[model samples]
Target: MPEIKSVPLSRAAAPRPGSASRPSAASLRYAAPALLGYVAVRITGVAILLIAASATGKDGMHRLAGRWDSVWYQRIAEHGYGYEVRLPDGTFHSDLAFFPLLPALERGLSALIPPLGVAGAGLLVSWLASLAAAGGIFAVGARLYGRRAGVLLAVLWGAYPTAFVQSMAYTETLFTALAAWALYAVLTDRWITAGVLCVGAGLTRPVAAALIAAIGVTALWRLFTAWRAGEPLRTQLQMVVGACLAPLGWLSYIAFVAVREGHPFAYFDVQADWNNRIDGGAALAAFVVEQFGRNVFAGLGLCAAFAFLFWVLWLCVRQRPRQPLPVITYCVVVVVISLIGSGYFGSRPRLMMPAFPLLLPAAVALAGARRRTLPAVAVGVAALASGVYGAFTLLGSGPP
Candidate 1:
């Protein structure tokens, strides 16, 4: 496979003697441009949002840290779970639907500073996590392609349509940060570190199931290859241990919910109340069909959007040097989960933010642009478009 030639698993698993164990000052310098570009894109997006909010007489800060799901996270931070609201239709909206890590962090930060409050703490966590996520993305791209591709990858991610969520009091940035670093750890052959970060990702969002699946699959593949080649048992054991640890955080939370609710599948039941269920895309198909029945243009638009997503996935798969198994597996799993689940349609893009690998092809193309200024111009245009879209959606009645 191209991946074997490009990034051999065995070689990554064992570092050379005298090499730095973790990112060093030089590594930070290397990724500074990508981090700076990402921050610039995000700042531009926020500035646009603020201007739009001012024009509409809406509070942008409140929208970012106090509205919709942010409210639920802050509520969890301020008071432990067991909060629920019943809609007129008799469905229960329970706090148990949210994972605990973000709230736990908000609670800790608020207590530490006292003046920051839960909302402020949540925003701070998201902002910092976004930068970390950008750096990790740069590292991964730089490892796979080159510094230029890596830089473009980070900038493009910041210019994503739902990139505004990265600046909000949301789990997307936190989960992306953990997921990116975990993938980087896997790329560099640090299985234990990957497992630990996977645990954190699992704690932050249900989407971490994708991350866990990626790690488990990669580890199993490595073990199979090693056994056939008669590789060292120590390496195999490390892979086994990491694979075993990957799902503990997600499973533990489910077990907690089950015990608390006095039902073996209480977690699923909680999610069902929120209309979040894995239905093999049945609900999505129904939604599209209903859209067609109501408005042909809206239905066509939805179909085009899905087609675009799959096209990007195809581009990712067709890259010159194949992506590592974990990267490909993780991206595919994230996309599958986003499409197959039944829930609020508008939130699907935000939920897929951690599927950063989807941007690899675009980043590579930008990096290889004939004109030196072409990449910058393209990224600038994308950032502007993203900013305007973010402002519009954020100011609208619906959740982004």
Candidate 2:
């Protein structure tokens, strides 16, 4: 066994070992760069993408600012989600698909300050959420690897081109923030708190199934290990309670959707009516091919979607080849479930955004690699360029 050296903030580090209640040098040293770098990178990416999109016209822009997703999100912010009459289908599609949490948060914050309007409130929430999430990511990384790797991981995700999604009226920032806190809680064995945060995350986005699944796996591992080591049953029981909280809300929603129709998976049926459901893997595969066949850029986006998933799996394999069973299980399952499920491939990038944290260590390691730096920089530039182009095309193309 490796000797555990005493860290500087012994008293403060007790139990969880890291908390804002008492300041510690290690905490600030690691968390500061991560926070600052995220802010700088996001501002820079948005600016660069904005400028490039302006220069390139529609093709270039679609790759940049993104499309009506942001607009629909804002609409939900202004007007609550409700079913609007279309044509044939009597089934209601809640503009509610946008979800209520982000807008509700924005409105709540804006009401607190007299001067801040809905827009200002929304920005404030995203801004704070982004910073806090990066901090949480830093804590996780630092604990798992080292301070350098942790900070680098946080910065990598913080500066990612798609981070603009966090800054917008979307729920990515909220979801990321909740997931980070939940992960931090799990790592520290704050089971109840972790479950609470996961519940919040699940409400933010259905994808939180990944977090719950991961936590459950981790808890089960703990239970098995405890039994093998001849530990008490109470500890294992508590872990079970902690892991179960993460999925309660999601399950309830699915049940509600099912009750609304004749069956539980009826949500998929309604979703299909929106041109948003998948017939099967064959349908999705054929659709993806058709999309890529549409144009050079569409093909590029498709490639990016696949690459993003691969990136997460690749990092998980390399860095945590033998990670806590729960973390690996949750991440792999979520990515697979998402890939196989129905939805437009274009949504995949955003859907897969939570996987951003996986990019950190690799980026950090690459940062130290004097030779690999150039190629890394080139790939980032290309990604930024595509995001910019995508944004413009999105505005012109209207809703998907």
Winner by TM-score = 1
Q: What is candidate 2's local distance difference test score?
A: 0.63
Model 2: worst 10 consecutive residues (lDDT sum): 4-13
lDDT of 1 by residue, 165-202 (tens): 88899999999989999998887777888899999998
Worst 10 residues of 1 by lDDT: 1-10
- After superposition, which runs of candidate 2 have C-alpha atoms over 4 Å from their true positions? 1-29, 49-67, 70-81, 85-92, 255-266, 278-280, 291-312, 367-400
Which prediction has the highest lDDT against the true structure?
1
Give the Cα lDDT of each candidate.
Answer: 0.87, 0.63
lDDT of 1: 0.87
Q: Model 2, 1-400: lDDT tens per residue?
A: 1222333221211343444444332366547877876676666655665665566563433332224555555555666555443656566555535445777776677668847766666667777888878887777766655565666677677555455566565677788888877777776667888888888887777787788887887777677767887999796665688888888866765666678667868656666656665445565687767877888688678668678658758766554532334445656766665676567655655666676555644655654556645534744564465445435433345323
Q: How well does candidate 2 score on lDDT at residue 217?
A: 71
Clashing pairs in 1: none
Taking all chains together, the TM-score of candidate 2 against the true structure is 0.77
